[model samples]
Target: MRNLWNLIVQYHIALVFLILQGIALTWFVGSHGYPRGKWVQRSLEWQGKWDQRMSQWDRLTELDDLNRELLAENATLRAELHTARRDGVQSTYQGAEVIRSTWNGASNPFVLNKGTAQGVKPGLGLLQNNRVVGRVVEVSENYALALPLINKSMEWSVRIGPTGPVARLVWEGGDVTRAMVYDVPRSASFAPGDSVVSSGFQGYFPSGLLIGKVADETPEFDGQFLTVPVTLAADFRAIRYVEIATVQGRMELDSLANSNGQQAP
Candidate 1:
């Protein structure tokens, strides 16, 4: 008790000043109505602002998770919208996050963080934003593999923009920057910037999904076909998230083509 008294004595003047200031503030707030009340209100307002700022700082840490969830929800809604427009026959789509990617000439495929648990299945069309990215080739209980359009063996039917001819879009194996569009009529008027889109003739993809833009066009010797170069819409090298399109009648179309020995345009 004596040591405590000596320590208080060392700062007695400071302690007295603090106590007097507190008493004065209380008296001013209690007795003075307008001016002191306004000051107190303003001080409380400042404290409230600080508290709000701290709350926002805490919420900032969840921004990424919020964005991802929003993206997934948006994809689901878009798929539902498409299904509605198709008279409820088109299969619903689901979103998936890419977990692994490989592109060393052994087939370019991506491993996604979705599988049967998420309604993901093999043969489902994969897309990014609004463009076709690939198709699901394999699926497990927890994950799936996607064969991206950049792979040398990948091919899809696509139509040129606004009445232009339809053709097969395929990667040429060596050039990653471009793909070859086959069977375009040499007489078809095409420019370097014409847009290409999914034909949806085979039911593997939705009509109007962007394929690429024409990069160049070369006429064959017989002047019957054009060797068209196309730049893909999806980067493939930097895809982070994707959606899988569950086509409802894709199997029927595939069986028909196999039986007839004909391909869809």
Candidate 2:
């Protein structure tokens, strides 16, 4: 303690001088308008920069939450539209993220981040951007598998328009952007630009859900029907988010059809 006191006594003069200097500088700045104004301006500038950086950080942190909210909103809107269609059943929707997908394969299957826990089940309809994407075929606790329209084995029941003829749309294992509509009657009147949509007969998507538009390719006559080429509206390669539609009473309807030894139209 005595040695510390001696050390303090030795440097006390310098400490006192430094303290006095600091006080003098403070007083000089306060008395001078120009110096004080410059100091205030610098302080404000530093504060503004710091605030901007903090705001950017906060936005970055909230981005994921914002995306989830958007997905929920979209699902609600879709459900409302489905109900408005009055397709003989009430429907609900849930949004999901596509974790994996394949477009260039014969049996193009995609995986979703939602499953039975989230009300996702087999035979549910998958939609993206208000257009039909696929149908859910399998499910686990937290994930589901779907077969897209690009799958060679997948055939969708689609119509040419709101009241047009219904035909089977199938992928012929070549182009990923196109599919062929078979069993279209030769008497059916449809142009190249007509919008093909779901017929709601397959028990997947409700009627009027857009599948694709008729392409400019010439229809090929196959005996009794005209096979038309269609340009698919959904881009399978870029699908990241989708909505799964669950039609109420669909299971009961399917069971009734099966009991009668027939398929649900």
Candidate 3:
């Protein structure tokens, strides 16, 4: 401690000079209006940058929430569109999300988050993005199973062209992007770009809903019907949201079939 005091005493003159220099520097800075203003300006600039970054962060969070809501809203609109396709077909529509799905198997099916509790039942048609997706085949309280169009046993009554006559739609079971339309009359001239739509025979899916577009026309082995290639509209691998349609006439039709012990013609 004594040695430290002695060293300070030896440097006291130099220290006083340093102290006077610091005071002078402080006075000089305080005397200048521009210097003071510059310091304040720098502080404000830093604050503004911080605020901008925080605001952008808040917007990013809000945008994510908005996107989810929009997806659900779009699902509802898809159901409404199916209802509008036919006048006399009494049906109810509701939106749902896919819980499980498989396209690589012979019997590709989809599982949804809604079921009998949500008014989903067997024979109800499933749709996504206003296009035909599948038909519900099994149901539980909170979940349901659907037979997608890509399934081998999956068949739908479809038309060759937009206003053309009825034909049967089936998946060829090889390429996921393509399917086959059978029983199309050879007399009807349809090309690759022609649209194929539903025929409303099942009363579940309304008539005139787009299924796909004709990809190619091939002469079937039977020669009686033209088996044409179709490019499916829905990409099964990317399916997310779906909607279920409740058809009114289906219950009555089911009753009649049960009473007669035979299916409807």
Candidate 4:
């Protein structure tokens, strides 16, 4: 208290001038209509801007919550759609967020905020906005590792169109938005905008799930087969929320295939 008193005494002249100046300004504004009106207007403007900023902050919080709800709803709908497509196809679909992902690597891998505890397991398929994104390759208690379509080491079984021939979709490691389908028959009737869908032979994704669209790039001829380019439907660079489909009979199918001396996809 003594130190504060000494400091105030040292700045007494400046403090007195500031106090008188504030009093004079207040009196001037209170006595003059124009100044009083301008002061009120400035105060209102500042308050309005503060209110607007608060409203924006509230909207951002609400938007995040709404997105989470929408993601969960979409996951439920996708699960129902898949169930309705096949009889006795017991699958559980859950919503997940991509916590980490890489699209610029030769073997792009992603991490999802789900794990064995959340029913996530190896061989499960991942989808974003109803489009095939990737498959879960490894799972732990609280996380899962997935390989996206951009991975050069991964190949997906896809068809050119609804009734078109099935081919092997593989990434060539250059463009993140595009992939190549090899062993596609030269006589396959498809145009630039034809859809490429999952063949379901791999037992990872459901049949007819959209993988990509046939790109406008020129096809390369490899003898009787054509290597066609495809524009992927899932945007790896923008992956946020995803749906994970857990096929119930996948293990059984794998077991049967192994007993028959065959590998399941």
Candidate 5:
């Protein structure tokens, strides 16, 4: 305590001088009109600049959100138009992001960020890049599970568009861009470049949903039918956005089909 008193005594003169100087400066500024005005002006200028910066920051944040919304809306519109022109059915489309997907396995599935809450349901057709991608197999309130066309367990009844045989679309356990169709009659016309689309006979997707084009044609191992290799129209390997094709009256159709043990006519 004595040592502290000694240090205080030592610096007392300097401290007193600083205090007096601060008081003199304050008095001089307050007593003068120009200095007081200058002080207030500078303070207001700094505050104005700060407010402007804050406003700009807010606008930038809003722009970021708006950009994302616009992109999503654009995807939905494009998909809707594409499906309407090709499918020729009473259907609507909703946009969704592929939150999870796998393409290198025997039974790959896709998880999307849309579900029942967004009007998504099982038996909904999924499309990407104007082509059939998959169908909704399961759903929750905010998400849905899909079986992409590349999955082994996924088989869609498709036919060669413009007078071709009805066959089955199946994955051969490899290749993301290619799959095969079986039961195509050997006598069916084999063109180098042929188009394939959904038959819509299974009541899952609308007809004329472009599946792919024939890449190659050859005889199956059993030698009874043609194993037609197809180049998929939709690229599932890097899909980011997808569209849900909600067929109108799906519930009634499903109920009737289930009751009859047959597809809806």
Candidate 6:
């Protein structure tokens, strides 16, 4: 208490001057409102900017939630579409994201984010933007493996667009960028730009899904057929998502094969 009294005594003059200056400032501002009003307006403007930044942060948080909800809704709609198509009803197929790609000769397989749980199954046709990508060769509870068009063992029945001829699409083990369309007649008059599409002859895929365009054509060893080289429509190296085509009457094809004591080639 003695020290406090001594310190107060030492600063009493300086404190008196500060109080006098504050009183004079208040009197000056109250007497002339323009300067004080400008200061108040500037302070309010600064506060408004702070509030705007906070509002932007809140909006970003809301947008993130909206995006997640939309993704879930999309998945649900796809499942319903698959069910409708399988039941022989006309409906749109769902798009599934590609979670992994194994194009490095590891059986030439890819993994999709959806699986049997999402109505995906083995032998279902895989497509990208209405172009044939491949087929589902393996499935799990939450994932499925796809055999891309580059797979050496992959084969499909395809027909050229509009006026072109039908042939068997097969991949040659040596060339990854090119595939051979076999059994096309030499008289089909194929050119370098004919579009190839699925024939749906086997009922595994819907007819008219694009396969590729003819990059070149040459006579085959048999001298009666032409080997039409196709450039794949789907760029396997850049594929990000694909649609799984659930065709109607898949079971009928299976039954016919079983009756013949044979499986799909």
Best by lDDT: 2
- lDDT (CA) per prediction: 0.72, 0.79, 0.72, 0.78, 0.73, 0.69
Estimate the lDDT of model 4.
0.78
Clashes (N, CA, C under 3 Å) per candidate: 0, 1, 0, 0, 0, 0
> Can you give the TM-score per candidate against the true fold?
0.68, 0.74, 0.68, 0.74, 0.66, 0.62
Give the residue spans of candidate 6 off by over 4 A. Answer: 1-92, 217-221, 257-265
lDDT of 6: 0.69
RMSD to the native, candidate 6? 25.7
Better of 4 and 5 by lDDT: 4
Write one digit per residue (lDDT tens) for candidate 2, span 1-265: 9999998899999989999999999876553222223443344345434544554554566775686689889999878876787758777888887766777767777767776677777789999877999998767656676788887766889999889988999989878889999999999999988999998877887778899999998999989999999999998888878888887888887888789888522
lDDT of 5: 0.73
lDDT, candidate 6, at 231 = 84
Tens-digit lDDT track for model 6 on 118-212? Answer: 89877788877678888876665566667888876557888978556667898775556678888888678767877898887655577767889
Sliding window of 10 residues with minimal summed lDDT for model 2:
31-40
Better of 2 and 5 by lDDT: 2
Query: What TM-score does model 3 achieve against the real structure?
Result: 0.68
Task: Tell me how far the alpha carbon of residue 101 in candidate 1 is from the true structure, in angstroms, after superposition.
Answer: 0.9
Q: For candidate 5, lDDT tens digit of each residue in 43-104?
A: 43454345445545545677645744765786568656756577445566777767667787
- Quote the lDDT for 129 in model 4: 84
Which residue pairs show backbone clashes in model 4? none
RMSD of each: 23.8, 23.9, 25.3, 20.4, 23.3, 25.7
Candidate 4 Cα deviation (angstroms), residue 141: 0.6
Off by over 4 Å in 1: 1-63, 87-91, 104-106, 216-222, 256-261
lDDT of 1 by residue, 1-265 (tens): 9999998999999999999999999885654322223443344345434544553554566774675687689788977788668743465677776766655553566667676778876778888888888887766656676788777656788888856777888886665667888898867787788888888775667777888898865534345777788988888777767888877877887898889898775
Residues 58-164, candidate 4: write the lDDT tens digits. Answer: 45677767877999998888777767876455666888877667777777777676777788777899888879998987665566777888887778899988788
